[model samples]
Target: MASIVPAEKIDVIRRIEQLAVGAGLAAIVQTAIKLGIPDSFDDGSVTVDELAKSAQAEPGTLGRLMRALTVHGVFDEVEPGRYTHNDLSRYLREDAPIPIKYLVLWMGAAWTWEAWPRLTDAIRTGKAVIPDIYGKDFYSYLGAEGAAGMGDFMKAMTAITALSAAPIVDGFDLTGVGSVADIAGGQGRLLVELMERFPHVSGTLFDLETVVANADPKLLPGGALADRTTIVHGDLYDKVPVDVDLYILKNILDAPNQQSDRALLNIKESAKPGAKVVIIDALMDASVEELRVTTLVDLFLLLNVGGARHNTKEFEILFEKAGLKFLGIKPVPGTFPTQHLAEALVP
Candidate 1:
């Protein structure tokens, strides 16, 4: 007869089993979103048959999906055969006040499903696998895929910006800053938020031609903030042509070191003495749970961009290498992944 295992040991084994099959859970959630199940109903509880009719899915299969999701707390099953949205499930709605549906979709994009399996190769080579798999870098691959691929990514970035922009602007002190430039600012959402918060501060949006072509309507000519906003299209690796009191580099510095360094040096070449640069992104130093999340993102970056999230010292080194004086970093309150604003000044 086999010796009996302790109850705690059996629980540990169960947890290991859960971790082993974690991908199934991710797939289930993505499937629900793709089926439009979240948007099919409102606050009221609906039967499985009603949900299936709205989603155009088979009632039996859709009920099974709902049962799995409800068990995971994504939605609520009020009784045997009825379900309703919970706080977590509401964010999956297409018209959520703080929309994150695109973000969820982007995370499960087709490329990601292919790339994640190659994480081991990326770790072994210390380079991105996207190039090997797609025959180009991540951005080039996105460009090649055109709107079908790039649209979800841009919208996802916008969704994330929607969540963090207000808090970042509220916490940032713009005193005496006449102008600010958002470097590689996708769609100028953050820049719009910044300009709105500090009416006295004029803003510049610098990014690629393709990206800036779709800048927030408020930043386009004849729009409300257009008079105070300037849109410039150029590559950051080549140069940053805007000279402003403050340079905002948000979520764009996670590229490999050479590119990140070059971007910073380009900014230094353009900025005047005493100009300030703030790098806003997630920090490696975080609570255990936050690290658990970011570490996965860190590897995801590795698989796509050959980048890693920087700790405080690594950030200081990046600033120093670019000939800027490192100031310090402070947490941006209300940000998920706990973004930190790392500051440096031109010497």
Candidate 2:
């Protein structure tokens, strides 16, 4: 084969094939997870018939699905017609620290998955395709879907936070910062973690009313963090509360529309002079693997919310426009996807 065709061309074709089948693989994985197939193997390697019965799936069909996933290294076919756990498949476990189950469910959601086919349309129209397909904005759809919908969304965010928050909390210097405010802080995960770590510093968790109402009770009223953390409900674009020394805009600025600028300005206005604003997000200009990840995320932002991941230079421009002084961007070491702590000072 190598003699007949150049290796480079063959590699290109292989990559295209992988990309083409990406959605199919995701669908299979999502289906298996939703069926609790991974949990069925907890006792050890199980035959196709046993596993299928446990997962409530057809034995032959589920066997084929498991074989395909095994080819992708999601599970181990220790012997013919039997499967067991692998590093990749274990993530589907219900109690995994970073439960990827929720992330998979959210990404495989109808509105989200359907929008990918309209990426070209979004590019042509210079708008997110979510509204065109779903007849409403992403957040509005989540709201209309009610508690179960929003809970899954929060679970996905919480999973991501579980991985990144520890690195972020330890990376920054929180000493002497009298108070901190986490804007659009979903489930108050980061704020709760920070307050627990730095008991000397008080913190406020700010987000939309519905989001705050669904925040983890362990972080709110009469809970572990209640004494040191105040959970407030409000839109980041409208107001971010005032008089906090540190304003954390972790995932806030990456929202669609002009919310980034408006929210940054709101934080600027709400902050006292010399307040520190830290943006915890993935920045461009990283290693090849990191760039690939961040670039994919930037595209997803376009598809989901009309936002794009930014580099330090782009953030400098945003801060300048929002009337804040750019301090610098610091990398949060020991993170999986690796994020930056972009710092700016309120003027």
Candidate 3:
């Protein structure tokens, strides 16, 4: 006879098993989106055969993929052979009120698949693995000609900006701020939203030349906000060549510490004595569920850029090191991954 394991222990074992094969779940969801399965059906339940026809997949194998997704609660299998969209699945639709399809695609992009496996090496060296694998930095690789999934990555950034821009702008008090600079703001989506919200605020959009070249048309010449918008192109690490009443660095400080420091110092060097500096990004200290999501992102940043999300203390230290006065941080409600506004002043 053999000794029996406790039920709790068995559950633990099952959880570990699930964790081990997590990649399969990611792959299946991405496959479903790529096959056009989510968009193929409307609100009504769909049969495997109908889905196969709409998605152009083999009925038998598509059924297997559906089973995998349904088991994860992504879709509901009401009948043995019929499936319908659940709340979770509906967000994968292209026209979702709050879109997430591009974000999902970006997470499962080809480069991530290559980079994740080298996490161990990244941890050991305390550096990014992208350079070793791709022979260049993460941005360089993404911007390289003929790069796979580059379009999806850019679209994903736009999707994220769309989701959080309203809340972020609302949380910020731009009173008395006549001029603003969005440093490293991709395509200036948030900047456009800000300028539209505060008609009196003239804004500057700064980023790499490649990125600002595609700035929102409204921010470009002859567009709605063109007269009030200035597009500057250069590396933030080299210099931030703008002086404004307020500077917004949104989700761009997730590079190595040296680079993040350099960015803050550059802002400090260029800003006026009382200029406001806002660093908006996800904080490390958060609820368990939020941490569960963000910790993975933290590690992903490490693998790609050797960056980590900073806690309040770490942020204070960062500001202090760069010779800026650390004010405090406040949560920006309704943001996914939960962003916080860490503010400072050029003194």
Top candidate by TM-score: 1
Model 1 Cα lDDT, one tens digit per residue, 74-158: 9999998799899999989998976688877887899999999999899899999999999999988987888878778788888
lDDT of 2 at 317: 82
Model 2 pairs in collision: none
RMSD to truth, every model:
1.4, 2.0, 1.6
- Candidates' lDDT values, in order? 0.91, 0.83, 0.89
What's the lDDT of the predicted structure labeled candidate 1? 0.91
Candidate 2: tens digits of C-alpha lDDT, residues 56-100: 889889989988989988889999998889888888888676887
Give residue 331's lDDT in candidate 1 (0 to 100): 96
Q: Which stretches of candidate 1 lie over 4 Å from their true place?
A: 3-5
Quote each prediction's TM-score.
0.96, 0.94, 0.95
Q: In candidate 2, where is summed lDDT lowest over 10 consecutive residues?
A: 1-10
Q: What's the lDDT for residue 250 in model 2?
A: 80
